[model samples]
Target: MSGGTWIAVDGGQSTTRARASWTTEDAAVAGFIQTTDGFAAVAANVSAALAAVPDAPGTIDRLVVGHTGLPIDHASRDRLARMLLADHPVREVVLAPDEVTAHAGALGGPGVVSAVGTGCVTLAVDAEGRGHRIDGWGFLFGDAGSAFSIGRAALEAALRSDDGRNPPSSLVAAVHEVFGGSPRDATWALYQMTDRIDRVARFAPRVIEEAEHDAAAAAIVRHAAEELAHACATAAEALPGIDRVAVTGRLIAPGSRLEREFIDALAARAAHLLTVPSAGSPLDGAARIAADGPSIYRPLVEILTRPESSAA
Candidate 1:
């Protein structure tokens, strides 16, 4: 097997992280770089990430990229691989969806995993290695248990309360305080924001804080927890004989109400599963894939080493 420098990248919606490592028989050196280009501009983002590595591109042996919004079709994957290899001189490259790396990093084996942050997604891998994905439809239609969802719910409730369509709550006052205007003015201000999804998601922490003393806010948080738990349960069911589940993302951070409510909801479902926190970051999983070659995503990864070896 070949052993040299390798780069691993975990590109997500909000931030992109890359790690460059030089490995020998018994030791390794590593460095990290972070960017905000996200998956929408994956090509440019990846190029920037690669350039951040301390070592020259020609000296790198391999690069494994697990990216959000990665194309699923083989043709598209090949096109992307070509684009990346055009500028860098890495010997081999492997690419797959970010969830594959998340699953590997969170569960490491056969189990279900729920990743909740700006968005939420649940993935399950059975003992037989069959994979199932639940939700993660993005901010517009899905991501039910995500921070974006919670923040949107809070904003809607505040708006409804202002219009006399819902009961008055602390959220209404909080919104008025933060946005600083009448309902119409607040609406106008929101529309002016460049990144509305991220701006709206900023209210998630406020929702959690208010939920400690407000009924409406508490209900929103609990419902979000229920939604996340349900996704986990559904995925677990799809992957039979799996009794372990891992939860990641900032929404369910330790010592938070969201985490407590999520656990309680799971317990209510009588799910005979061992729920645990993730052991490593997605970049770690990407590194593992680079070192060991493909595993679960063997069919999805494209190896762009030789000119003729372009397909997965």
Candidate 2:
């Protein structure tokens, strides 16, 4: 194996994590750091991660960063690459969308990956290496079947129940228990919270819990499962020769009712297809891409790997 230091970073909107490994002909050492997200925040975390190792900035060979809000355009990606090169002494760097790394970690090869967390997005890669992305339009217009969606639905149901527009539901009681107020008061408070999306998403587990026995909650869960399954199936259909779909993110935790329903719904739509479980975390995928030289992120990798003079 080649002897050098490699760094992998996963930068989400909530938190950022970086792993650094120094490998030589015989011995190797690894370190990890956690910090905030964003270009500057991730760079700072990367520096802190490398601080424990000797000759960090100068001796680093490769760095791969999968960030949540990275730009999709080539010019924008190149701009970010230049910024990273200027900030660090690493020989090469690769920047990719966090979803790409999530798909890589979940599928590791050609297939479809549906990530349902605070938000939802589905990606499919064809046999010929073409990619299709679906339903990542953010929380306002899209992100169907996400925790935020489920939570929002629950809140709506609770409000309807409180106002006597909908039949009384266990969700009303559940919402009152958590938020300690009437549905109207809870709704107003949700609007007042700074991180309303995340705060509202915090109620998703409760929705899931109530779904076990509450008809209204069960309806929300079923609807969520249907929406998520539809996204996965839609993406899969666009990618010819793909028979496997992998699911990632907190919303699809194994053995949960949500997962069971989602898989069943998806299986019904796509015959003879497999729902593969995620084999590794996104950080593992980032490391794999860094070690493998390049794949989907070849453009960014090439731009960063080129000599400074050539780049100029």
Most TM-score-accurate candidate: 1
Over 4 Å off in model 2, which ranges? Answer: 1-3, 22-58, 296-303, 306-312
* Residue-level lDDT tens digits of model 2 in 103-189: 777877888888776777788877556778888676789988888889999999999998899998999999889889888998998
Local accuracy of candidate 1 as per-residue lDDT tens digits, 1-312:
235667888776666777766522211222112225333356777776665656553546777888766766778777777777766776677886777777777777888888876777888887566788999777878999888899889888888888889888888778877668755577678888656666677778889989999888999999999998899898888867888888887667887999889989998874587888788766677877777676665643568774545322
Model 2: pairs clashing at backbone N, Cα or C within 3 Å = none
Evaluate residue 40 in candidate 2 and report its C-alpha lDDT on the 0 to 100 scale.
50
TM-score of decoy 1: 0.84
What lDDT does each candidate get? 0.75, 0.73
- After superposing all C-alphas onto the true structure, candidate 2 shows an RMSD in angstroms of 5.3
Model 2: weakest 10-residue lDDT segment is 25-34
Clashes of 2: 0
309 in model 1: Cα distance from truth in Å?
11
